[model samples]
Target chain A: MTTVARADGSAPELLDRLAADRATGALSTRAGIFYLSAGHVVHVESPHSPDLGELLTRSGAVPPAGWWEAVERAGTRHRVGRHLVDSGRLTAGALELCQLGALFDAAYCALAHGGTVLRFRPGVTHWLGAVRPVPVATVLHESWRRRELLHRIWPDPAVDTAPLTRTGGTGPVALPPRRARTLALVDGVRTAAQIASASAHRTFHTLVELRRLAADGLVAPAPPPPAHPATGAGGAAWDEPDTALLRRLLDALEAL
Target chain B: MPGIDESLLETMRLPGARGALVADWISGLALGAVGEAPGGDAEATAAETAEFARLAVESGTLAPATPAVPATPGTGSPPPPPGSEPPVQDLILTTADAYHLLRFVSTPFDSTVFLYLWLDRTDGNLALARIRLAETADRLVLG
Candidate 1:
């Protein structure tokens, strides 16, 4: 039994050691707790997990400006959902969904960064009924469902990360589908500004679209090529007689 | 507030209701269900539906397909800083014969549960069913 100080320090190390040992147990960290069995993560929870705050903020249940302070308070109390509800940051229903989203997100992140670093402890109790983090398969499935929902709301996937680029060339470009057009606007060349301008509709809408585009392989940053010298027959060693001969041939052909 | 069983029963009352189930997406567990068994099985169906959502977001089919415009020669758009929230959401699947809806409900605790509803295509009005489901969700109490 290896005892360590601080949840942060012990959590990551325990995950690594568990992976090395191929053991199964619950690993608890300041961020959250997750379950692992047979070198596979099965569940996760984080202090600041999911989209409850965002949902509340977006739905007008909570003031966006007060989110950070609430999160800070949650750090000490470790009960963000309750805090938000008690403070009237969000209604009970919204709080539940947000907490669910956070739980799903944390579990997804852990599984995506896979390889046995989680385990289950028979006697340990973590807040939020998190016995351990969920398996990668489970996390992945949930994440996929969430992505699909976003897609239905806004069909295009290009606006997920890179700023929205709105410039067009000389021709009239037919707009994408209705859902896509609503999420993306064609500004002349201002990407971030366009997104910021549209942020009033929803702060994360543009961002989510960008992320989806990137995920779909529809858009990507063009990588710069390595520097290399030009190579052709036009080097200094080229014969000067070639031009003279060509001129003579042309003159002869014209005389004919 | 309506209990889980009552909600499932209410869902069954909808016209052309082939089947209905209240699922916890996080665990893929069927809390309550009514009607015909889904062809593939409940757990498998839930898992597949969830996977569809994740793939859509990861692949970017949810948004437009255009490159981010580069900033002016002298300026560059700031990188999305680290520790930002990832943009994603729960999913709904519709078929020619049935309408499937999954909604995430927030609980007082940190648990996120979803209600999955399956409606028969031939006899159900998709629009009306969605509205009903949303209303039903309002009164549900998660355990």
Candidate 2:
């Protein structure tokens, strides 16, 4: 990664330089605030921070789909924490806790990486931090540990960003501890909705089971639905057979 | 008459009580604490314990298996997910000589703090100590 230092001592200026240069590296300030770039801040920990989307999901205050929609809508216009609170999704106390948590996590990551201040800019600053090479083995081990703790396997990153879906696949999966007899019914052929319809278990339990299965490398990511031909708003597009069929399926699912 | 000090004193009364301290998990700062001083080193232990709590919560390994109740809107985002809450709020470490219990108390002020206790394992009833600690935490008020 290319590193550049700016004489302008301001956070905004540093940020501008980075954006102008299209540079990717850890940025920090003397104040101990720093940002890591991983598809947009894989981690951020500051004394002052917002509730991360991950924190919101874990809190169970917002559904994953709902949170994603909010994020997309908010983009960078609104402070995420403020947006969530304004939307009546969280309380002030909860917001404070979440912000603290995010900041703490980000700080830990920054410290672990041995971050250095590169330059200060007005509103934007860049700092270089030591990059700790994370081994894939470490990730896998942590994943396994998480699996054991949550008692559910969640191998898909999409679950964190997009709506959950089921994809069909054929594979022999080995579950840790002991495999439940109920898991025998999962063949990747059934949608989560379908499984829910057929089973008497709670939705949370079924979802957890699906996540575990996905984590065990037994299930594949679901394919995106085919695009529909452009049609007038409210214009019946039954003219295109595929569009009509997909529409019908979506409608059916919505009804269910 | 002060709540936190009284709580600390009560913790000391427990069988084999070594020391007791209160800490803020957010900033890793100790508010008030008493006991063994661990060779006159309560601050270090309090800071260390706070770090432990923070790490445990962030690691998601020892997080509570159930989700915390969502705070009312305007308070910010909801609590962390199920299995994201730490369980060592009142940690009881069993050693050959003493039992250490750290109990966390979430005040209405939104400060995530806890009381750390050390008791002699030989004389402590792990369960009873936990109950008393919980009660003590409830009565505590931050200065």
Candidate 3:
């Protein structure tokens, strides 16, 4: 709790300044690291969003061995994405979509806490390179819009951190295929973040589906925490959220 | 193979093509865009079109039978592989003076995105645009 947003400038402000300066480097926040090129957000890695490898290989897009090969060949130069495309193992369109999806998915959580910019290293770049560079204004605006959209669907954020399970009270609950795939993984043990990785679904899309499920009374949301100090502005708490999430978040955040 | 920028440029070359965007339905993001946006705001248009596209794909009546699940078991009609043709290939919305086409882009992984092309009805060929848009979706590279 005490570790969040100690600086007067939060995520948006810090990013705005960097964007204004047309800075190219990595900006570290409490939630994740955002790689910027000439003030544009090129890549992002966060605990809330599954990494590119998981999004690709875990979804059966590329075999584990093939992915490993790409990393071996291109990891050092931060061109794993380009290498995958060039090697014909993956399409440029597919890689781009995945990276951009991963970018916004994680960036939403990264900016959610309004965490202070922990540290910024000039000229530091992601190993994935610049797959799709988006302006800082667009990135920031999209993050805020996503938060608003999710809130409109379901105001409470508890469902986000809660483990989900079918109500099981009703038989034959018809659902869209995507939501069905997501719901099928809700075993009351795996939370939304786990479901995102396991299902190869975008983090925000997973949240949208879960919020809808909660709206439909299909899954029980975690009861609102009692004014936890670790919660974000909208009562979003990644801490003690299934324990595993917190640990991974810590490892990912600390490793930076 | 055309990357996003190049693909959009190709779309712009189409007759009556006012603008086009590589929009992600799931995230409602414009991966790339070229030319004009109907509302004069590309991002807002991307979000709205994405919302419309998602509803179409999610609604059982609109979406084709699940591609992953074959209708008949052991009938030799195996379901399409993942990342194959999307359940909804393309959606055409006819407006008062324009045609909005959303062509879903299939990927190796679960795909939830499309190419949105806005064309002037008088200048654009719906049939040709449909064919070309689909071709663009097929060849539109990302990396």
Candidate 4:
């Protein structure tokens, strides 16, 4: 398992080498893409982490109207961040901080998982433009650290996506400040990511807190989405499906 | 003005500072780093420090006691502690030859990240380093 995981581990190494060569392009991974400029990682995006636009709006850093205006105006030119900063929708410092946070957060998920197929496209730029280009080495090092952190917390990946339920019947449980904030938002229907979105917290932090809560038995693991009734149990429905079809056909013939 | 990289660079200026890194305690990922890492590996150091920070922040005994639940009628559960300031301000670990300082940075965003500074015990001024770290953590601007 480790070897198979290590196979894709070369993605980061290849990125570092590309950085050494001052290569410019995008490295597409199974989870996300990293856009590099002259070997420096200018931007990264992933399905796991919320995008900068959403993060900013959710945090009240930038209003929805402002974000929309910036996007509508600069999205075509691939300079959304620049537009936000230039238009004073966000301070340059704030934009840099949010941009970097979004980049690293996405990179953590992109590089941590294994079996990722990596492909590079030369001379590509992210739509947000470059707020701050992080060193390739820094991104790799942080991604490795994030993986270790998650493992140390729970050592289980199931908690990452499972719906959360209270462990027991409302028994009093102690929660740290951060966990308490997160617990208020979990309704058993939301996965870690959903809770993060609803709570306006970092997705990575929400996952870590969920893992910790799971380890302490404060939350129960999702009972695998009640597996769809097997064919054997639902076989009768499949056998009888013609009634609705036949009724619809009869109605259509009568109308004709 | 002090973003992640600038904040890290500020920490490296303290006397006897061996290395400094900004790492998220929740995910244990280093946001930015400067100088040389202890044991020559920044990632390992971030993970180790994150473990210590997580344990300290999450300890019920060390956590500040929750205030009494509000008297609002039929509040299904106790209201969480008011105010979002994390209990831990800074943590320091002393070894035979070096001191490790983990200073948590407060932000309005979802995550908690701390600045970790490894100082040479022989040359580091513990008192001065602590004061400076606090200031840097305060001024760090995170989006």
Candidate 5:
């Protein structure tokens, strides 16, 4: 593993440099990877973010079978997005929206995982092809703005990772369809990530809604998870000294 | 139907068009934008526009009443009336120098996106713009 050290600079800087160089292909960080084409960001995939296929399938735009077929048939064609559009499974517009939403969603999490071991493999394209290439500047700017919006509503970062439950006092306030859909999935046992997986809304948007709901006093953080003694030492993956140092560096960078 | 990029370009073709953006009001994120922003900051403008959208759609005073669904006797809350139109079609804000139109776009899927058009008040025709914007919104196909 090509461990990217704190001396390599921040994730934003790395992306900026790649864009400046007009680099093409995948930049793999330990947390996830960002795929670029001709310097523009084409796709981003992170474990913390729900997959684009799942988001699209759940959106009722294309059925699961159609999505699976697209993935399977992408093979050497590398035109998964085009296949879907040509097959009338979805419109070019809808595909663009889904790709854009997923890009921003995954990019945010990728940037958050700043200190991971970073490796860039040139000419590595995603199977989805390029739905639409978003400018790197816009992607970074929007992610930063989204982070601010979340903080404005609920400053506690803990609210983001914890399971949520209704506060139970405010009379039913009418929620928008997506928010209502998301709220229905918040069963008090699922974290924000889990809730996003269950709902059709994009993961980032779901988290934003959760923060908004938190601000409205409609939801509160569930108590911490019980201590699992059996899981000890097995969780050593995140305890690397470099990882801790990188996280601290990221925190300092974000604070700036 | 025009995808977001083409739609945005079409919007800017309107007379006196200052700028245009396709924004998801729920999350205050811009799907796409062209030309300049009113405040010179697209992100800030999106957030401000979202506040308007959230208010217009959420407020009972502003939300249009749905075609009434017969209330069931035993259900705690009645089933929502079928086929309710979106709360607001478009919101037009006439400032001293510009005409700001927030046209909500509907989709077969959940519709939370809207077109924000900023036109110079002196030269832009509001009536024509309104009609064209609605047509654009109708023709828009969101994936």
Candidate 6:
């Protein structure tokens, strides 16, 4: 048998290994956190993407009061999803759809993070519980596909990570209403994820819209963040290398 | 409300259904699937079908026209209410050997999920499959 060089090496490799062993636990990556149950990815959370509750309340799936109540009553037992459904706040299918959406949305960013520090804590399931267990393969494969799609739509990754501003040109830009609305939210301070949360929209969808905006010159990076964010002027305070923050300078242009 | 697996099973009960799947149109991930996929790979099929659905749903030329702001009673149907059902409810594709039906499900969120059913052409009743798929979509549970 050939040596398994890649097993548990990268996020994808580790997930594959876990699936093979039917392992259950949480995989903590710099990009995001994934909770697996018996080899199935029950939930995934990314710092750059809205969580299930955000998606649920923002989408008007369940009222905010009801959502908090469910969490208070059932979150500790990992039955928040079930609680919401049983309480008739929403149907089981609706919760599943929303949960899947949130999972895939965050999973894409989580994997896109692609950092080296990947850790898995065995037997630690998410308090949200396994609303619907997605196969690990499906999660990884979709993340790759989304990365490719975003690249193809607009090869620039800056629009995804950088703060954005609208183009000053007065030319009428004919765009679908959805993209137009997302564009209006750009104020040279909010990154795609910030805009997504502020608008209560899916972070991935917001990214797609931003990419499209960049492709059409409707949006542009506000300004390049410092490339080498080292050595503070006041004192030597080493800050955490926030992936999203560091990435803001990846495509930064030379200061004019 | 039938959960995803139960919903798939319900669709499979159709007379000519060869397979069934629930996929997110936006992410192209197969949420739940049962039986053989047209591509022999459920994930692959889900992605391809999602592409097909996006083309139909997002195309400006094919979507229903937005009604003018001012009230005009004697005119075509008003555009679907924002955040309501998608303009196009379902789509059907006929192949040489089988029939494919995609029914969009409305949810509290983006409503990006759809039900895909593959039915044998010879034995499948297109009308029946369409109705059942729509019903299944209405009640298919997720969590």
Candidate 2 local Cα displacement, residue A164, angstroms? 30
Predicted structure with the largest DockQ when compared to the true one: 3
Give lDDT tens digits, candidate 3, residues A1-256: 1123233468789889989999888888888899999999999988888888888888888898999998998989999888988898776667877788889888997887556678788788788888889999989988988889888876666667676666647587777777777788888667788888888887788998887876666765443445646535745443433453344346559979
Task: Enumerate the candidates' DockQ scores in order.
Answer: 0.08, 0.05, 0.45, 0.32, 0.35, 0.40
What's the residue-level lDDT of B126 in candidate 2?
78
By the DockQ metric, which is better: model 2 or model 3?
A: 3
**Between 3 and 6, whose DockQ is larger?**
3
Who is ahead in DockQ, 1 or 3? 3
Off by over 4 Å in 1: A5-61, A64-78, A86-88, A113-137, A140-218, A225-256, B1-18, B21-37, B43-116, B119-131, B137-143
Q: What is the TM-score of each candidate against the true structure?
A: 0.43, 0.33, 0.84, 0.73, 0.81, 0.82
Error of 1 at A225 (Å): 9.1
Give the per-residue lDDT digits (tens) of candidate 5, residues B1-143: 46888888998899989999888877788888899999898777887998898778766565644534566554222344454435567889999999999987765444367889999999998977877777676656633
Question: Higher-lDDT candidate among 1 and 3?
Answer: 3
Per-residue lDDT, model 3, residue B77, is 27
Candidate 2 Cα errors over 4 Å, as ranges: A1-256, B64-88, B141-143
Candidate 4 has a TM-score of: 0.73
Position A239, candidate 5: lDDT? 36
lDDT per residue for candidate 6 within A112-187, as digits (tens), equals 8674435678878777877888888878878888999888887777677777888658877666656777888999
- Residue pairs of candidate 4 with colliding backbone atoms: none
* Tens-place lDDT digits, model 4, residues A1-256: 1111122446777787789989877878888888899999999887777878778888777788999999888988989988987786655545665677788877876775552656777777777887889889888877776677677766666666656666655777777877877777777677777887776666777877887876665665544444477756644433222343344356559979
lDDT of 5 by residue, A128-242 (tens): 8988898888888888887887888766555566667776565777776555666777777787778877765566778878877766657666643444764566344323323
Query: Model 5: residues >4 Å from true position, as ranges?
Result: A1-9, A113-115, A170-177, A225-256, B64-86, B108-111
**Candidate 5 collision pairs:** A94-B143
Candidate 6 Cα misplacement greater than 4 A, ranges: A1-9, A224-256, B65-85, B141-143
Candidates sorted by DockQ, best first? 3, 6, 5, 4, 1, 2
Indicate the docking level reached by candidate 1. Answer: incorrect
- The deviation in Å at residue A231 for candidate 5 is 4.5
